[model samples]
Target: MHKPLLTTDFLDRARRHYADEEAVLAVDGTRYTYAELGERADRFSAALQARGIEKGDRVAVLDPNTHYHLEAAYGAMQVGAVHTPLNYRLTPDDFSYMLSDAGVDAIYADAEYAANVEAIRDEVPTETFLTNDADAVEGDWESFDAALDDADPDAYERPEMDEDEVITINYTSGTTGDPKGVCRTHRAETLHAYLISIHQEITDDDVYLWTLPMFHVNGWGHIYAITGAGARHVCTRGVDVAETFDRIRGEDISYFCAAPTVLNMLGDHHAEHGGATTGDNDVRVATAGAAPPEATIRTVEEEFGWELKHVYGATETGPLITTSDAKRHFDEGADDRFAVKKTQGIGYLGTEVRVVDEDGEDVAADGETIGEIVVRGNQVMDRYWNKPEATEEAFSERLEGYYHMGDLAVVDEDGFVSIQDRKKDIIISGGENISSIELEDTLFEHDVVSDVAVIPAPDERWGETPKAFVVPESGDPDDAGATPEELKAFVRDRVADYKTPGEVEFVAELPTTATGKIQKYELREREWDEEDRMVGEG
Candidate 1:
């Protein structure tokens, strides 16, 4: 029989499971025993309580992945406080909007980022402030360690949490349009964590390199699973390719989850300087987002001996609903292997995924057909905060119960899901839903371009035109540049003339979110300010 599922219950069980085991290992050679972790978490709970934080009160944290940050998260969870982790890299203006929207009452931040929140603290609801480094804190922020220093290392009595109660109010950075708050429940988080622990094979024996930020779907729901499974967590604040390599070797890290970009960075780093293959140091990389290009997937596996596990999900879907891990799919011919790897994979145990056409009828799973992918499961968000109309439209009377993911995709007969084109981000020039990603992917084949973000620029005749933001790779090490004409000519020769960017802007970097997703909305704002229509929305 299934037992009672509870957040604190998982904590208790994990504590027993890994009693003598080291539950966390930091990059700087620090370790926290499972028993010690429980104490630190409890101390954090007391610290928050002393600061007047109460159950269900929203506590916002703005810190990168660190051991203390993990303690703060579990502490907030223990008190039933809603954990709202903010991206520290966000400007004061962004913090202002998010803090006001979430009604955050208390905050914890790192030394590097305390100032951003400090600039807007007076205007925000945040009262108690804790910055890990006191000397770096400004605007009445106090020391973080001070609170926990004097507090007793005792377990906080966990409040009764219903399955549907909101545990996290994760804010999307709004890469396309207005940012929406995703309210994930205890049940959804627990189950998704359970899915990762089981599917990813996380256990006490496993040591995790905390590469992904905790703010992102709770580190793609690995924080809970890693902690729930009593696995060791090695903390670090940045993702330096060299540092990542050293930490993997230094921490003896066995498992890590990374975006396709990170995998690409590692692959490039390895190409520049040789590294290990087929050893404990040869880690398993769980890649998501943009489905690591076929070449990327192959290179990572063959060169580094990385066990590449491809999976896909969104912020609203509790992040780990589909994975390409079915054994039969991989056991086929080489063409079939590549074909299976291309899909977003199959649904998790309790998750249901469907591809529906324009009329909402289920689409064929021939792998060639494309349709919008919608999901119905325990992992679905409760609703978009303060946006009932969008929420209603997202859930259908036809599915009768499913949540509609705005993504368009297709599936193979073997049940692997493949993302096609985004419903929006589709460029319309003379009435064609031109895929900007397709054009951008094609343009990436050019050697001159280091990185690119494709956006729809305003046009008088066609309503929109493709615009390219190109960053030239530093070739000379001292010289910085890419001529717009060079970028334009490079893309023109490869793609259709119309798809070639009407305007090319040379920049050092394109703006991106914490998760490394290109902030297309920022680019769209500059492109569509004068236009009557919005470029990002369909």
Candidate 2:
């Protein structure tokens, strides 16, 4: 007989089968078994119900990666409430907008970030506020710890669940305008978590490190996936080089996921500290957001001896659809393996990833033809929360049933996909198309360039020309040595003359989202603020 697939099954299975297993190593150095964690989640759920949080209510949780974040999600979903996680990096105004937009009825915030919510408490529509540390916030609010401590775990009844019902309303990282909530069904999240386990080789033997934030797509759905697999989760408040290295050695961490920037930091730290000190521990890293350069991949594999796997997706597509695991037949040597790791490999097992032209025809696998990436799978989000127009646009009729990724990519003969640039970040100059990612990758090869963002600047001759905002590797970022002419020569020698940036503006850093994705839209807005059209007319 078949049964419904609810997220609670993950927690229930763990509590029943892996009750004695260590489930969470909290950021504060506390450990809890699966049974204990399940009980805590149950108590939190009971407490929410006691506070009048009925089924279908929208509850928001704001915190960094912590045990509290995990519990909040599990607890909120347990009682049939839709969980909405707030990005801690955002401002109070952003929080106010999101709380109001999602119609969040209740909030559970970590003590450290309670102040952010407190700042706009009066303006927000939420009636209930629970802080992890009640003393940390001003005014009256429920204490998360106290509520759970006082509640009975077995006192409440779980509502009958429909697997296809929306359980989470994850908001997009609003780089341009207000963020939109992507309503995800319980079925989608469960399937995504299962796919993560299958692709990442997650097993009970694996120990996971919390380098990725739990708020970002529920830590890319690792919270449930890791628990379902009975793996140990080492929670961390933040990413610290020293602490991360310590956990790798101390906790025997075998797996983690991070953006390329974090991986680069780890690589730099290892090199500075006389190379990786993990001894014989076999650590594997999954990186995304931006593809690491070929050199970075080589150093990560050769110097650190840790396997690097690259995966790609967005918040709408289960946030995971492609993985770049090195295949034995395709990899003949270290160099070949590094090259393979740089490309965002084929679709995951049950995912359908396609690159199509404007006409909705599949592009040739020549690796040169650029097309938009579209996805259709079990994990793809059903729709945006209360935004039918946007949902229709996202799942455009041009592709019939697939969701448009808004990312332009090229697929190789072997079906490996490499991203060119976001649809809006592409530069058009004098009837020529230029990929900003291509320029950024080339600039990354320069010894003195640290970070760079390429945008289209208004030009009388070329309609629009490429302009670079650069962060140098040494001295003052505004130093004249990071000269426009010098950087122009650097690009001219490597790529076509048209691809060379016309001007270089040095800055301390590029504007980025909390996830370390460069906000090219901000730069483009500034450059074309005065133009009749913000984006290139071409």
Candidate 3:
């Protein structure tokens, strides 16, 4: 009765049970049922075989959140090829490096980004260069649609797949250096999909909006979880506030995932537009990449009548480790509910999460002690692709088996995990540790601050001091927007003065990865460009 777990089973289930149900609502206004989508995948798989793509060969997909992205992923993986989803925002050089590094044999790109691959086609070792746009092919490149048309859906056969085999390799955004590919096995991905479904309470009737990019950890494994539940997937070209509002009302969207920054944009837009009717559709949103401020959570629940679930995890951890659910808090007051919804709640089912110190011992649950968040579960990745030393180091500085999350956090008495900051983003000022995330979160309380990033700046008197870069809502620059002294005074009453930034630099925008994570390293590099080392010894 025991069978190997594979990701393909999810798609198969959708095809079998929900064959005639609407599966995808593409940005181009095309809708496909589960049966139709499966047929397209079959044709794509046959086309890959015709083009000489063999088992275990890497096939790269470069596109936005589109039906083509989903089809390419299911098609490539069904025939035992390893699917690699590239970040379309990356430059041609990055594409070339990743293609060569992964030994990619075939590439399928969207029309908007095919030129990026074309620029580096000669430098990479890839063979088949195909475009989703039938009319956009250039020199030697084939049309993806035409190939799909020529291929027979029934001719392609599924290979005997090993659950332990790597199904997808997702490259990091590489804010610091060249990106590293995180190899995700079929077993891990399947388990992660189940976790997402359980935590998000997905159902067949639920409609999922593709606010998150599919290339990022396969949309945090929602692609499998939603499809497995026989839910509807509405794909958008990209995240847009106006488009999101229209879809939520028009399509009656039930669930979606996005960063806190995106949530803030939507919330701000909703406020400006006078609270459009969601039309009896109970919307639930899952947010990560930083906890939304208590005020943002309050606005979302009170004004829009939407539920906010704050989850936490990294790309290496199958990305669905912990969720902040309001039911566990047992609080009824508005302030108490808002505060509880803001913390990265408790561990997901079958996951063990802890905040531990350098000694590998658990920190006290007093909520004051900060430590690295470590976790272990079926969802954790087996290893980084071709980087044994890096893989070993990732699991080294911890207890025997747990993987370190590199994020500093504190577990409260109720088991609520709140992230203080990333390990590298912490600021050391006069021998006292300061959390830049804490400062950023506190600064977000200011109405004028649309965005903010905090980093350590060289301070002759205090080793290193906290410095703040802020983006004002009014688009004013050079302190004409919000004076540094006014912002400093605002924070002085909220948190410890030591935690407050010594200097505030107003910028139009903060440097961010394509995934919308603030790149503190870039800010640090600029501040320390003139200095040999960041800080001096006492």
Q: All candidates' TM-scores?
A: 0.79, 0.81, 0.80
Q: How many residue pairs clash in each candidate?
A: 1, 0, 0
Candidate 3, residues 1-538, lDDT tens digits: the string is: 9788898898899999999999999898999999999999999999999888877999999999999999999999989999999977666877988999999999999988898889889999999988877467555778888999999999887889998999999886422345678999999999999999999999999999998888878999998999899999999988888999899999999999877667677877877887573745899999876566666687777788888888878788998899888584756545677777777789999999999998999999999898989999999988888888777867878666888878778889988888765566656554344667777888999988989998888765554688999999876766446699899998876765666799998888889999999988788878877764332111
Superposition TM-score, candidate 2 onto the true structure: 0.81
Q: What would the per-residue lDDT of candidate 2 be over residues 1-538, giving only the tens digit for each residue?
A: 9678788888888888899999999987899999999999999999999989978999999988888888988999999999899777666776888999888999998888888789898998899999887886897889989999999999877999999999998887532344679889999999999999999989988889999888778888998899998888999987887789889888888999877667667767887886344634598889876566666677767777778889988888889999888475365454667666777789998999999999999999999998999999999998988889888988985588899988788999888888765675656554334667777888989888888888888765455678988888864676645578888999887766777999988888888999999988788778767753443421
- Write the candidate numbers in order of decreasing lDDT: 3, 2, 1
Q: Model 2 residue 275 lDDT?
A: 37
The true-versus-predicted C-alpha distance at residue 190 of model 2, in Å, is 0.6
Candidate 1, residues 38-154: lDDT per residue as tens digits? 888889898888778888899888888888778888889888898888866556766888888888988888888888788877898888888888887656777877888878766
lDDT, each prediction: 0.75, 0.82, 0.83
Give the residue spans of candidate 3 off by over 4 A: 174-176, 275-277, 425-538
**How many clashes does the backbone of model 1 have?**
1
